[model samples]
Target chain A: TQLLEQSPQFLSIQEGENLTVYCNSSSVFSSLQWYRQEPGEGPVLLVTVVTGGEVKKLKRLTFQFGDARKDSSLHITAAQPGDTGLYLCAGAGSSYKLIFGSGTRLLVRP
Target chain B: SQTIHQWPATLVQPVGSPLSLECTVEGTSNPNLYWYRQAAGRGLQLLFYSVGIGQISSEVPQNLSASRPQDRQFILSSKKLLLSDSGFYLCASDPGGEKLFFGSGTQLSVL
Candidate 1:
C-alpha cells in the first residue's frame, strides 16, 4: 500500500501568521489533491496538482507538488480564523481510488 | 449537475444490531461508487467500491459488506454491528475519472 504521511498533525497559530502543512510518501503519484473539511461536513476539494514541480495558488493558499510526485505541501499566508479546519492530501491510486493522508488539523486564532 | 445522497445522518445502535446505510447518485449513469470510513482524528479509508450493478470490490475484510443493486445505488451493510464499527461513513461517486463528489455522510455510533 502507498502511504502518505503528513507532518505537524496539529497546528495553532494567531491570525496573520503563516503556516505550512507537508504531505510526504515514498511512492510516486500521478496526481495529488488537497481538501479542507470543516466540522459536521465532508471534505471540500481545494486543489489538484497533476504535474511534478507544480505550484498553484488559490487566494492566500499556495500548494506545491514535489518534483518526484512523492510529496506535496500547502502554505497559508496571513491566516484567519476562518481557516481553521482539517486539511487532507489525497492521491489517486488503483482504479482512481483516493489514498488519503492522515491529515493536518489547523486552528487560526483571531 | 450531479449530486450524491446518503441517508441517516446520525445513528446510534447497540452491539450486534443489523446495519444498513444507503447511497444514491443522481444525474449520472454508470458512475463509480465508493464507500469510505473515517475514524475520529484519522484519514478516510476506502472500504468498498463498485463500477456497475452487482459489481462490488472490497478494499479490506471486516464485519461489513457492500452491494450495488442498481447502477446508481450502493449500500453498506453488516449482519451484526461491532463496537469497532462506530465511525463516520461517507459515500462518494466519480463519473469516469479522478474527481469524486461526496455525500453529506452518516455518523454511526455503536454502543
Candidate 2:
C-alpha cells in the first residue's frame, strides 16, 4: 500500500507565527495536492503541485513538491485563527484516486 | 459551475440495518465519482471510484459496496453495518485537472 506520512500530527502556534508541515512517501506520485478541512466539513482543495521541484503560493500558504515527487510540504506564513484546521496532503494515483496523508491539525491562536 | 451533493447529513442505525448513501453531481457529465471514509482524527480512505456509468472500482475489502447506475450518480451500500463502519463518509467528483471536488460529508453512527 502507498502511504503518505505527515509530520507534526498536531501544532499549536500563536498568530503571526509561521509553520511548515511535511508529507513524505516511499512511492512517487504524479502530482501532489494540499487541502484544508474545517470541523464538520469535507476537505477543500488548496493547491496542486505537479512538476517535481515546483512551488506554488496561495496568499499566505506556500506549497512545494519534492524533486523526486515522493514528498511535499506546506508552509503557512503568519498564520491566523482562520488557518486553524486539519491540513491534509494527498498524492494523485491512477484511475483518478488520491492517497491522503494522516494529516496535521493546526491550532492558530489569536 | 459544478456542484456535488451528498444526502442525509447524519444517520444513526442499528447493526444489520441496510445502508444507502447517495451522491450526485450537477452541471457535469461523464465525471469520475469517488467514495471515501474518514475515521475521527484520521485521513481520508478511498473506498470506491467510478469512471463511468455501471463502473465501480474497490480500493479496500470490507462490508461496503458501491455502484454507479447513472452518469452522475454514485451510491454506497451495505447489507450489514458493523461498529467499524461508523465514520464520516465523503463523496467526491473529479472535475478534471486532477483535482477532486468534495461534498459535505455524511456522519454515520452505527449502534
Candidate 3:
C-alpha cells in the first residue's frame, strides 16, 4: 500500500505568519493534490501538481511537486484567520485510487 | 463539473445496529465514486470504491460493505455496527480521474 506522510501535524500561528507543510512519500505518484477542509465539511481541492518541480500559486497559497514526484509541499504566505483549517495532500498513482496524507491542522490566530 | 450528495449529516447509533450511508453524484455520468472514513483531525481512509454499476472494490477489509446500484449512486452498509466505526464519513466522486469532488460529509457515532 502507498502512504503519504505529512509533517507538523498541528500548526498554530498568528495572522500574517508564513507556514510550510510537507508531504513525503516513498512511492511515486502521477499527480499530487492539496485540499483544505473546514470543520464539519468535506475537503475542497486547492491545487493539483502533475509535473515534477512544478509550482502552482493560488493567491497566498503555493504548492510544489517534488522533483521525483515522491513528495510535495504547500506554502502559505501571510496566512489569515480564514486560513485556519485542515490541509490534506493526496497522491494518485497509475490506479484510480488516491492515497492521502495524515493531514495538517492549521490554526491561524486573529 | 461533478457534485456529490451525501445524506444524514450526523447519526448516532448503538452497537450491533444496522448501518447504511448513501451517496449520489450529479452532473456527471459513469463517474467513479468512493467512500472514505476519517478519524478526528486526521486523514481519510478509503473504505470502498466503485467504477461502475454493481462493481465495488474494497480497499480495507473491515465491517463495511459497499454497493453501486446505479451509475451515480453508492451505498455503504454494515450488518452490525461497532464502536470503532464512529468517525467522519465522506463521499467523493472522481469525474476526470484528476481531482476529487467531495460532499459535505456525514458524522457517524456508534455508541
Strongest candidate by DockQ: 3
TM-score of chain B of 3: 0.98
Kindly provide the TM-score of model 3 when superposed on the true structure, using C-alpha atoms.
0.99
Model 1: CA > 4 A from native: none
Candidate 3, residues A1-110, lDDT tens digits: the string is 79999999999999999999999999999999999999999999999999999999999999999999999999999999999999999999998899999999999999
C-alpha-based local distance difference test score of model 2:
0.93
Q: Which stretches of candidate 3 lie over 4 Å from their true place?
A: none
* Tens digit of per-residue lDDT, candidate 3, span B1-110: 67889999999999999999999999999888999999999999999999899999999889989999999999999999999999999999998887899999999999
Query: Whose lDDT is greatest here?
Result: 3
Native-contact recovery for every candidate?
0.50, 0.75, 0.89
Question: Between which residue pairs do clashes occur in model 2?
Answer: none
Q: Indicate whether candidate 1 or candidate 2 has the larger DockQ.
A: 2
Query: Relative to the unseen true structure, what is the C-alpha lDDT of residue A87 in candidate 2, on a scale of 0 to 100?
Result: 94
Scored by CA lDDT, what does every candidate get? 0.92, 0.93, 0.95
lDDT of 1 by residue, B39-65 (tens): 776689999989889999999999999
DockQ of candidate 2 (2 decimals)? 0.81
Off by over 4 Å in 2: none
Error of 1 at A54 (Å): 0.6
Worst 10 residues of 1 chain B by lDDT: B94-103
